[model samples]
Target: MRNIKIVIEYDGTKYKGWQRLGDSDNTVQHKIETVLSKMAGENIEITASGRTDAGVHATNQVANFRIDAEMPTHKMRSYCYEYLPDDIVVKTVEEVDLNFHARYNAKVKKYVYNICNNKAHNVFNRKYEYHIPQPLNVEKMRKAAGYLIGEHDFQSFTTLKTKKKSTVRNIYTINIVNEDGNVEISIQGNGFMKNMVRLIVGTLVEVGLGERPADGINDILDKKERKYSGHIAPAKGLFLEEVNY
Candidate 1:
């Protein structure tokens, strides 16, 4: 079996997310795997670097699958490009070492949240960006994000109810940049739990809006409760920007 890696970019506006949900075929993974299975005359399972939420976009999502076939990597890429939905595109495909596991080998993952902090939303990006028609205190949001930079248990920020798994994660960096009413919060982390990024963004947005104090971040972390965190931001505003191996 040869391990093949592929970089994928998708709008994710119409699909149900990245992971296949049992017999339901409304996921990106199911679509890609189904097409690959047809081309290779066998079942094809792919492991992605991360599973994104519904309506979230991805500029460069990574996945790898093992197949026993003589098909060239370029042909495989072409097949995906031709058969996959128009919203999903395969950016690159190449054979990799057998040990290259997409999810386990990922060193860092970057997710960016886009906010239209203006009176009027940009019609071109309305589907991908969240519109908040109010002036946001960017400096305050930055201050709140500082509290999340190091390793800590993020139990307060995630909606995951399973207590068996660890909620501890390390955040490498969190950058908030605003340009002409466009706000982008880019977070690089070792790993993110379910709804963790969206929850963090929501909490920071409250700080930016003066609804919550920046120093209150400490209490939220200390409490380690989901109710202490802010609302989970909308899925359309988030993007899986990159994954580093």
Candidate 2:
């Protein structure tokens, strides 16, 4: 078997999510798998580095699968480009070592969230960005994000209620930039649970809106309760930017 690694870019507005459900074909994974399986003349199952919520986009999501076919990697990639829908694109495909598992071998992931802090929304960007009519304090958001850096038990920031798995994750950095009326926040972390990025962004947004103080982030982390965190940010504003192995 040949282990192939593929990098994918997708505009996930229409899909239910990344994973394929038993009852529905409206998923990114199912869409790609259907095309690849046809090309390989066999059922193909690709393992992604992580899952993105519905409406969340991705610039460089990574995945890998083992194939028994003798087709060239470039040909396989070309087949995907021709068969997959316009919204999903396979950026690159290369043969990888047998030990390089997409999910287990991933070292870091970077997610970017965009907010249009303008009084009115831009027609072109309305689909991709979150609009906040009121002005935001970008500095406050940055200050609040500082408290979330480093390793922490992020139980409060995730929606996964089951405590059987570890909630501890190492957040390497949080970079917030404000340009004109656009506020972009980039978070680099070791790993994240379900809805973790959106929840963290929501907490920072509360601070930016003056609804919560920057110092309150530490208290939220200490509470270790999902209710203590702010509202979940809209899925449209979130993007999986990169996955580093």
Error of 1 at 12 (Å): 1.1
Colliding residue pairs in candidate 1: none
lDDT of 1 by residue, 185-229 (tens): 999999999999999999999999999999999899999999999
Residue-pair clash count for candidate 2: 0
Assess candidate 1 and give its lDDT: 0.94
lDDT of 2: 0.94
lDDT of 1 at 193: 94
Clashing pairs in 2: none
Estimate, for each residue in 110-214, the C-alpha lDDT of model 2 and write its tens digit. Answer: 999999999999899998999999999999999999999999999999999897999999999999999999999999999999999999999999999999999
**Which regions of candidate 1 deviate over 4 angstroms?**
20-22
